[model samples]
Target: MKRFDEIDEHNYSSDLIDEMFKLITPEAQAKTHYRMGLAAKIDDALKAKGWKNQDLAKALNIKSSSLVSKWLSGTHNFTVDTLVLIQMALGIQLLDVGEEDKPNATSPDNGNTPNAPVELAKNIDAIKQSLTSVANSNQKSFATINYK
Candidate 1:
């Protein structure tokens, strides 16, 4: 008995419904996909190499196996230090710590390509130099203002 608007009608269609579901779903995101893939690869590698969770824990210098388990779960937001340790232990380069893989990298949600590496590096260096200059200027200003 009620007349639906165009937006409401579009929302009820199966295709639109599926799209909406994907947009709202965590697993549908690219970052989640990348992380899950990485986790599976790590899991397979560990099994293939006969390395146990305890072994990884010991190698990372973590006392508890639970922490290692958490790392392998793909849900834990690992620190850079932990990621480096894992890379060394597994001998697998999951992330490109260097300049590679920059151009093709995308925003996690929309998959937009990242900015050029050279430009990004230049901007970062400029910011660093500016901050250092500002700090030096501040120190000089304080010294000049000191009466004693």
Candidate 2:
């Protein structure tokens, strides 16, 4: 067995250990986890659409296959713009926010039907945000959406 000093030369024999080391920073760990989550979502979407990396890149107007390869590698730190573009182009949601991220729903996927109040409030909030965005884009004045 190699001594601890030998292993301390910034090298590790185990791939798992190496990966763990890469996640030593809290920020890096969170970012890596998020990246992997998005990567898994992208992988599922590709499989569902029967698309190769080239197909998605072409659809997203991304000319570089290498960039797509990096995205699929589960290590790419995607920008919000890139994520938004991908979601808009593919029509597949990769990130869940607000009520969408909440587990409570009124159906098999949504919140429980018995608990309508919570779900209703969430739906209203989502609609309000949509309306606000639409109204703003149309140069119409509207009340800002408040969490309350």
Candidate 3:
């Protein structure tokens, strides 16, 4: 038997952790990814608005800023109402629920088709900003979308 102090650093194998991660279902992984992505977006919006954790808490009517921190940690499962409240407070769209799908010429996945679903865009904000800049400018707008 090897004592904890006696064990070398190389004695531990990360394969067990890798196998444990492999046990997670694709749906579970996707859910986690979306949650973490949403949390990141929230953090970005907060920074853009120059708001602190306490400010967000105040906006959400939450008494504890710690709870807001938990929400930003990406582990918290957010309720729809809470999400709506957050969206309202931050002036950002957290979720596009119950909206009809519109094919965007800006998206490469849709291939300018009206019927194709616009795959979730990672750079939608950047694209929008660029488009806005082009619109404001007299130059012709040419957008290049790279979707993963």
Candidate 4:
């Protein structure tokens, strides 16, 4: 059988898939991005610690490396407890709750207020940090990045 790449471009078109992707809700897209971002963070942490899927599986106390593979594939529906376990094992924060130095305040909206757009920008920055921390792993120290 011919490989997919060997097929003539004229024989197929990506319009259907493209349109389907376009139909996806922004919320769904954001969820996918965050899931993939978390996966990348875990993969980077494993590499930095000179570990493999088996090592992580052992650390996580799972019998199957395939489970780790699924997590790395960015499709795992990770639970908060599982995330905490992974964070503990890897010594990295998979989710950024807020600024460490800042005091916590109880918002009336529980943070989803009239200033939600501003808060969203900050949340995006936190996501960026998780996604890019591996690139800066070699640095001795770095300043905290604030998105204003």
lDDT score, residue 119, model 2?
45
> Which ranges of candidate 2 are over 4 A from the true structure?
1-23, 104-148
Give the C-alpha lDDT of model 4: 0.77
**Which candidate has the top score in lDDT?**
4
Per-candidate TM-scores read 0.49, 0.52, 0.59, 0.58
* Order by lDDT, highest first: 4, 3, 2, 1
| Residue pairs with backbone overlap in model 1 | none
Q: List the candidate 3 regions with Cα displacement exceeding 4 Å.
A: 1-13, 100-148
* lDDT values, one for every candidate: 0.68, 0.72, 0.75, 0.77
Q: Give one digit per residue, the lDDT tens place, for model 3 in 1-148.
A: 7778887877676788989988987556656766787788799999999999999999888899998899899888999999899999999888766655654222334435322112333356678989889787744433344446
**lDDT score, candidate 4, position 78:** 92
Between candidates 1 and 3, the lDDT winner? 3
What TM-score would you give candidate 4 relative to the actual structure?
0.58
Per-prediction backbone clash count: 0, 6, 0, 0
For model 1, the stretches where C-alpha displacement exceeds 4 angstroms are 1-20, 23-28, 99-148
RMSD of 1: 12.9
lDDT of 2 by residue, 1-148 (tens): 8877668665457889878887576456545655776887787888888988898899988888788889988899788889888787667887565655465322333444423334456778899999999878766333444445
Per-residue lDDT tens digits for candidate 1, residues 111-138, read: 2433333445677899999999999999
Which is the winner by lDDT between candidate 2 and candidate 4?
Answer: 4
Distance (Å) between predicted and true CA of 123, model 3?
25
